[model samples]
Target: MLIVCHPVLYSAVVILRMVDRKLSEIAYSIRESFHDSGYTEIFPPAFLKSDKVDGFRFIYRNKIFVLEPDITLRLMNRHITENSKIYYISQQSDEYLNESLKAGSEIMGGDEDETNIEILRMAIKILDNLGIKNYNIDISLTGIFDSYVRKKDGQHLIRAVKSRNYPQIQDMEIDDKDKLLQIMDTRTRKSGIDKLDSIIERIDDPRIIIDLGTVRQPEYYNGLIFEIYGKQEFLGGGGNYIMKNLRGCGFSLDLQALSKLYHGSHERVEK
Candidate 1:
């Protein structure tokens, strides 16, 4: 059977090819950055037999597979091979055929402070490689949540912080209200990191702001939390987290978003 193609369909095919070429270049550039930074790239198993993950389970060949949401949880498991530094690029299908392409790096099997610095530095280098300078890494922590989470209306407060909903935080009757707002204040991040560290001057610096208020709901984030932003849009981000008993740090880049931004198709970001 011969299929007819409209001029509009031909145009759409051309646009897709252009977009695919751009994406390939971006992926290669980012991967090279990871390699230059001493990170070994790995294609982690897409399906795992154990551990809780965000994906649904399905049986294949009489065996069940749990689709992986991310790699942080696998690092500390005794069964998983531990490495010095690593990164990966992969995607998971959503409810649609198109998948979100992701690329990120991690500092595993390393000192706590050293891991933190290396990951943050790498985050900056990634932004630089992408020509994204108008950005800030909003930093926060789990301890703040661990202590204040038990307070009245705790869940609401967390939502406010994660969404940056100031009115919700202001209206809450919790005792930590004022303190939470103060933490959300970006102006205090430098001083806050300093307060969290005695030798801030000695460390490699990145543009940072501290929002010690609410946090992203991830079981892995039992330590430092951060989100990278270019103005209001999130470029990419991650944090110091515990994968079981071992402490590690890593970040994931939103490859699709960067492509959209670079292509001046930012309006389609939601689509």
Candidate 2:
């Protein structure tokens, strides 16, 4: 029998096991939260048809197969029943992406604003359970920048804005780059519906900040968009989108990255 006695390798394996256990604990707690909210977990097909998403592809029997880089497309089809609230935690594969788990949910058959509010609230609840206090959810209306951006060159402007690179934006052919810059400077604003603000206001959570600037790709998102962050890392992001003409919104959590929040203390993680 070959002997295997590498102490360094053994320690690395132990560390991986510890982190894995903590990640499971976090996922379980968050799953219960979803269940309490009437969302049943689902396992989506490993591959699906949609030209909207980019992922690794292979040909089998002359048919094209690909993995989803973004889980948002899983609900792109309007097969979801009205009044069905669903969540899924499954492996997601994409071009250039290795090892990722996404926990997401979609609320169908509800009022549009209500869906936005519910999904945003649930996103907060998930992050809360994970003990990520130094975080905020930046909310923005999709297509708010439509008037200023040309359909042909909007993606480039969006990338510059997303990176907060003002110089790059100014160099673009756009006549009014300042208009886009102003959106990036925002911290908060009131939507016509005070009720949505009412829910978030009382939580006394400092993590919520409204962003009026983030560019929403009309093809991807149509209404309210939100992203969750811990310090500077993007833990999750989702928003309202029209898929197959069906209006809906949802969020997806990065389960693997969430383990970094535990900081190696199992006792605190168990808490």
Each model's RMSD to truth, in Å? 4.9, 2.8
Q: Give me the runs in candidate 2 sitting further than 4 Å from their true place.
A: 1-4, 50-52, 189-204, 216-218, 263-265, 269-271
Write one digit per residue (lDDT tens) for candidate 1, span 199-262: 2344435467556653666666766667777766777778877665556778887887777555
Q: Residue by residue across 170-268, what tens digits does model 2's lDDT show?
A: 788886656667767877645454543653575445667677766544357776777777776778788877666667788888887777774434576
Show the colliding residue pairs in model 1.
Answer: none
Q: How many backbone collisions does model 2 have?
A: 1
Per-model lDDT: 0.67, 0.73
